[model samples]
Target: MKHNMFCFQCEQTAGCTGCTGRAGVCGKQANTANLQDALTGALIALARTIQGKQTVSAKISKQIIDGLFTTVTNVNFNDVTIQQRIDAIHRELPAGTADYDMKKVWDAQEDIRSLKSLILFGIRGMAAYAYHAMILGYTDAQLDAFFVKALCAVGEDTWGMDELLPIVLEVGEKNLACMALLDKANTETYGIPEPTTVPLTVEKGPFIVVTGHDLYDLKCLLEQTKDKGVAVYTHGEMLPAHGYPELKKYPHLKGNFGTAWQNQQKEFDNIPAPILFTTNCLMPPRPSYADRVFTTEVVSYPEMVHIDEARDFTPVIEKALELGGYAEDQPFTGINGGHTVTTGFGHGAILRAADQIVDAVKSGAIRHFFLVGGCDGARPGRNYYTEFVKQTPPDTVVLTLACGKYRFNDLDLGTIGGLPRLMDVGQCNDAYGAIQVAVALAKAFDCGVNELPLSMVLSWYEQKAVCILLTLLYLGIQNIRLGPTLPAFLSPNVLQFLVEHYHIAPISTPEEDLKAILGE
Candidate 1:
């Protein structure tokens, strides 16, 4: 039978290949997958139309960014919202615009599909960063212009690797700029994040659980609910909110409610609190707490309460009060059974202690740096991350971010050079911060970033990780370790090219990879 849909973008693809049946591994329905495909085709159509114009305006840029981000894995599963996006894109076209069938790209030669997938998925990740910055009143003309260029390139049939390869690296280059813009917007608005300890327990009282990576939305919710009886807790990617100075000051902004995004269906089911989704990583809601789930910004689902541009969170707030939370304090611990986690070791915080870190390395007090970070998912192979961190040498430092940190964030790794051994940089967008720290260390040691005794051990579940990986490659950083499995879209030839040029390796056991990385 012909496939109902095709998606292989995230880490949890079925059978280590694309999902091509009635439903995706993440529980996305076939129709939802079809709409996502249609939305992407429409974005490509919109890009083709925009290419003919003399100047691509900011309004057009926003539309392209919005459309791209909405189709990312676990972002939007609502047919109504996606169709509305399709209609809106159609409205923007001058005339005679038709969506380029995504099947064409999917059916292309394996190498071609690999390159194009890189372009398409890279931009999808970049779009999330651009959207976050735009919400905070920051926009880059160059960054916006590239969206039009990249989308148009994805639609071009005659282009080969010679034509598409540079664009892939450019996606990395532009993503760095986009990440910087988002980092600037966040730190300037919320104040630089500091090392803050966040409890996993949910305090007794009416409470709201806010998830996703949008800190601005969380800040707004904190403002509106201030002086009210409701308490607010961060979930998943929002866990880093506790480290921001401005956000942590809120008395009612209590702590994190659950672990990563994949566990939400079980964690939030019939819970006493309401949950708000500010951006992506939204699973299709379970019937138990579907009504209590609210969405805003680019996140949407049918029948769920959506907080619109007005940002009025009254509906979500009222639901929190109605639930009235638990009768008493409920203690929750991380996967490691620890009651608290530490975060907010952002670039600034890390750099401020640069001298101590440098001295530690010089004195052999710190042997190496392992960046064990990225998104988390449901697959059993993901346990590799927990084991890897557990097996790291005591003298090594671990820097992590994004939802993946939840795997072992609660573990007490002890101190290195007066700084916590494991430092939590903000969100995935804060990969810029991680880059900054790496560059500074390289400079301090008079060497290249890859030459600074630092290695990247990354786990990816979504497009955001794709873009970050591309950025590292663009910077000519080498010997990176990626797992639990390689992307299915990369055919043999393209995979060979990456292996020869970048030395990228599929991860093995914690002991083996650690020995290899440390040159044992």
Candidate 2:
């Protein structure tokens, strides 16, 4: 088929293959997708050039990180913005080396292609965490250096599993450090998140729904809208905002809005209030709700109002007032018809209750722990997650995050050992919290995280998920079941490597996978 471009990097790719027409299933124009690929190629070339150089400045490194992350699915949907970033990267190079062709890496041997994809995609995800940490004044040299090393490895041909395996693990290892940096930044800036309950119903009157994965933006919005008669509610990945002491202190920071990222199109339809997107997972806006959609920081959509560095949110406030919302307190519920959703079960909160959790485990009150979380997408088979969570034994603890939780978050899974079996652990970025809890559990049992009676059933749809997966691999955590399907970008050889090294498997039906996971 003669197509305008190729874009299969996401779950919504056209025809279950690469998007080769005028626009992607993700609504990304062909030109924009190609430009993203070009930006990524330029980054690889820059990394290749600086592979052995020990004198690269932090400014150059930051540009490389930002440029790669900007190309990630749903991050930068605007061609003009991506081009500007490409030019910025070119300007940073020493002006002597030829630009590396990205198509070469994409067209390499299946094995090499797969290995490189892991390193590349893993770094793309890591950059997001690093960017978030950077915004909070946290930076790590080791974490920054890995991006360069991993990028250079993607362009290297001498690597096989024996050589690339460590790099793959390194992505996970470095991502852990990156996540830690972000954790420190977030906790230091917003205070440790405590257990918090966020309602699903939107309070009547003027209110703004803040989506995306940035806490600082949410904090800024809460600060700006204070005393303005405008209420702020978390949406999508922002559901965790209620946990942070600094953010929750705001009296007007109301409950969550909508569900997962994929459902935004339908959920936001005719929504009276303005919605501000602060990061990735933004879908193309529908006309009915387009006027109310706003972008801030790196998230940009055509024709949407964008709040700049000034961080002024007056436009959002005005729109909220204009919308007026519902005249009465409109009651809303989650997919499972629950009127409330609970979040903020972060590491600090979980570990504080560690004694209870350990006692439960020792008494056999909590038999198995399942961390069922990841990005949510439009794929049809993704219902497997909700079904999987539903099928979990009553004695199991279900810890979830990202948009994936929306599939089953509303379900009343009841409790085990005085803790809600289904625990919402904040957003995808808060995967750091899940890691902390797992580590604490292992420490309590005096075993490795993998050795604990814990399992991670993850579903990934974008780069941020990739970084978290890498962090998991880095810690040598094994027996993770990931699905609804593996990325087509992964070659068979690379798949074999992951299976042999980490015992990662594709998800099956809930019943079958559950038996396998539980050794039934």
Candidate 3:
């Protein structure tokens, strides 16, 4: 039997194995899936051609990074964009070079397939980081070169677990570097994020909702609309924008408009605003608000107005003004009905109060630390994260990132040691920030990171979380509790290896897991 498409790269894969029907669980169609596969194959071909290049240039890095990132889940749904990337790779490759068949890797030995999947998906996530950094005019030659090497390794015929396992971990190593590059670029370009409280209300008047994870795109939109009588509200990963010193300086860069990306279709229904998508987590828009959607920076959808490299958001601005927004301020609340959400507790802000945090811990005022964060999904099991946060003891500090915090970001978790009990650590790319806080805590206590009073309770929905998990594993962080479900691509033996070596556990009920984590 011929399959139209086969994908299991995300947490929501059908049957927890793969999506093999007309569309994936995330709503990706068969045609889009096939096109994405072709795009990946072309990237592998380009990597094979450049396998031993003595010198790779910046142009080569950007294309490969963007292409791989485009294939990430929910990033690009436009067949035209995927085909354009594939065609560009074909033009860039040497004569007679051929694309590698992804089917070979998919149908390989179970262990081999598992290992290669890690490499491919891990790099796909890293590519998002590289792409973000590139947009800010920062590119690390070594980091860029790893994408070529890793992609080549994934396509290699002779590499088995012995060889592929090391490459899988190396994806973590390179992802760390890639994230650091992005952090530097972001902070230097937009200034370090300070702790700021973002309201859930939308102020009266014309406003555009900027979603996705691109700070540069947000910066451009803010600059273009500076005094244009239009307000800018962040959505999803863009919520951290309010903490940036440069970004928050703009009076019109107002509060966040909705919850996580998964709820956009419902939240945006006939909404009187234009939504600008700078990166991933874009759902297929409903007809009610489809005309108000505008995409930019590699995010494309059929029939949506796309803002190109010129960085002009006049079209979006005009649409927002034409909508005229609400005559009265529209008050909004988070999933918990809280009036506001707090963010910007990035490494800089967190570290500023490190002394107080340490003292609080020593005094037994703060009992534990839980990094409960990742992508939020539409699955019913996702409610466990919200409950997990709510059930976490008042003495435990919760540090969250990505869209996962939307599960409970608005909750009033109280505080300890002059720090809010729950802290927001910027976007998924800022996993590096969480790592920094972890490493610093370990050093303060003179122990390994795993020995610190910290636990990583992660919820993965897409490939970016895959790379972040690899980074955590590469750093030897252990006893991580991952849920609401495990990735279906991990063969039994591969899953056992992780379980035995790292004690990785699928999350249980909130009460049971909390007891186990706290040794109660």
C-alpha lDDT score of every prediction, in listed order: 0.91, 0.85, 0.91
What's the CA RMSD of model 2 in angstroms? 2.0
lDDT of 3 at 240: 96
* True lDDT of residue 208, candidate 2: 92
Tens-digit lDDT track of model 3 for 171-255: 9999999999999998998899999999889989999999999988988998999889999999999999999999999998889
Which residue segments of model 1 deviate by more than 4 Å? 1-3, 52-54
Give every collision pair in model 1.
none
What's the distance in Å from true for residue 355, model 3? Answer: 1.0
In model 3, the runs with Cα more than 4 Å from the true position are: 1-3
TM-score of each: 0.98, 0.95, 0.98
lDDT of model 1, residue 285: 90
**57-95 in candidate 2: lDDT tens per residue?**
789778877887787788778777788888887887787
